[model samples]
Target: MLNNWVDQLNNTRAAAAPFGEANPKMLTAFRGLNAAQGSNGALDAKTRELIAIAVAVTTRCDGCIASHASAARQAGATEAEVSDALGTAIALNAGAAYVYSLRAMEAFGQMGK
Candidate 1:
């Protein structure tokens, strides 16, 4: 799909290096949030990563998809589970497009003479 995710993951980390160096506090805060969110809280790692993957898909974020999908695999999500999550994301995205099309139709009706 996109770049090989392993390569992309390395690239993402490398790219973030400059920003992290320039703003250590912000980077620390972000890492803290990531750590806290991904830990064994109410939701386990696999579930959190699956949710993240779904969110990444819905948001159309290539980098997020790469990162979260890799994390999801490492967190023990089976291919079937990932596929199911992606299917849900696909349906939601399509549903959003379908609903938004109705807005366009409404606008056209109002503007037509």
Candidate 2:
């Protein structure tokens, strides 16, 4: 396994506790956002968790990966489904790099003029 995801989730929660305590308002707002998402009902939990996993991969957030992976599992996301989501993330990252490369080339061309 890449990581002890359960332990990582636990550790992340533990580490976040102090920050949450230090800034209760920020924590409340964050929690409110989560609650709003949960109540939205437009997407099911499994789909949301899958999207979260993909975003976590793209953002390189270990904590989010651990949390969302567990949530995905609990929401009945198959391994194949998670893999597909990851593939999408990989493709998006590659696409972003390709777009950025075009911008770099544009800047390089401008520098030459």
Candidate 3:
């Protein structure tokens, strides 16, 4: 079986504990940000998680993906909804890549001058 992402998250949290302990201010700030961002107000938990998952994919963060995906599941997101959200992520990634490739091509052209 593949390595469990939840386990990976647990391990990362364990490893990060020392840093968090050593940097109380940073940890406090992080906790505050997490609480503020994670709260469900106008948007439901599931929707917030879906947005998080999409951003995680766009940012290419494995930890965020695992954490948010798990949260999405716990918040009553179905497999189909998760799949659809990922599909949206995939499309956005592709579009971003295509747009950035134009900048890459421009840079390459400038380098020859």
Candidate 4:
């Protein structure tokens, strides 16, 4: 029963996060693209998983992050790699959010009370 409930909830999440709703073709294409990327010989398994983690972090996607991080660990991403990916995400996020926030601050200054 517990497993069934978990499966249902996971299905719900997948349905909710469909690619371009009402477009089954696009969703199919998205799945194909992911499969190709995940299994391509050009990039090792570890590299692909790291990329997934980065995507998860960038989108602040808890579900994706949890899923990808678990896969990553299973596929041999060491603790170091996980930590490094997180650090890289944090650094990049700080810069990204900072650039926008800094501009907003400057704009606010221009608005003069």
Better of 1 and 3 by lDDT: 1
Pitting candidate 2 against candidate 4, the one with the higher lDDT is: 2
**Residue 9 of model 4, lDDT score:** 41
Best by TM-score: 2
C-alpha RMSD by candidate, in order: 2.2, 1.1, 1.9, 5.0
Q: Model 3 — TM-score against the truth?
A: 0.86
lDDT of 2 by residue, 1-113 (tens): 77898999999999888999899999999888977886858989999999999999999999999999999999999999999999999999999999999999999999999
Worst 10-residue stretch by lDDT in candidate 4?
Answer: 1-10
Predicted structure 1: lDDT: 0.90
Per-residue lDDT of 26-108 in model 1, one digit per residue for the tens? 99999899878746578888998999999998997878988998899999999999999999999999999999999999989
- Identify the superior model by TM-score, candidate 2 or candidate 3: 2
User: How does each model score on lDDT?
Assistant: 0.90, 0.94, 0.87, 0.77
Model 2, poorest ten-residue lDDT window? 31-40
Model 4: pairs clashing at backbone N, Cα or C within 3 Å: none
Model 2 spans with C-alpha error above 4 angstroms: none
The lowest-lDDT stretch of 10 consecutive residues in candidate 3 is: 8-17
Model 2, 23: alpha-carbon shift in Å? 1.1
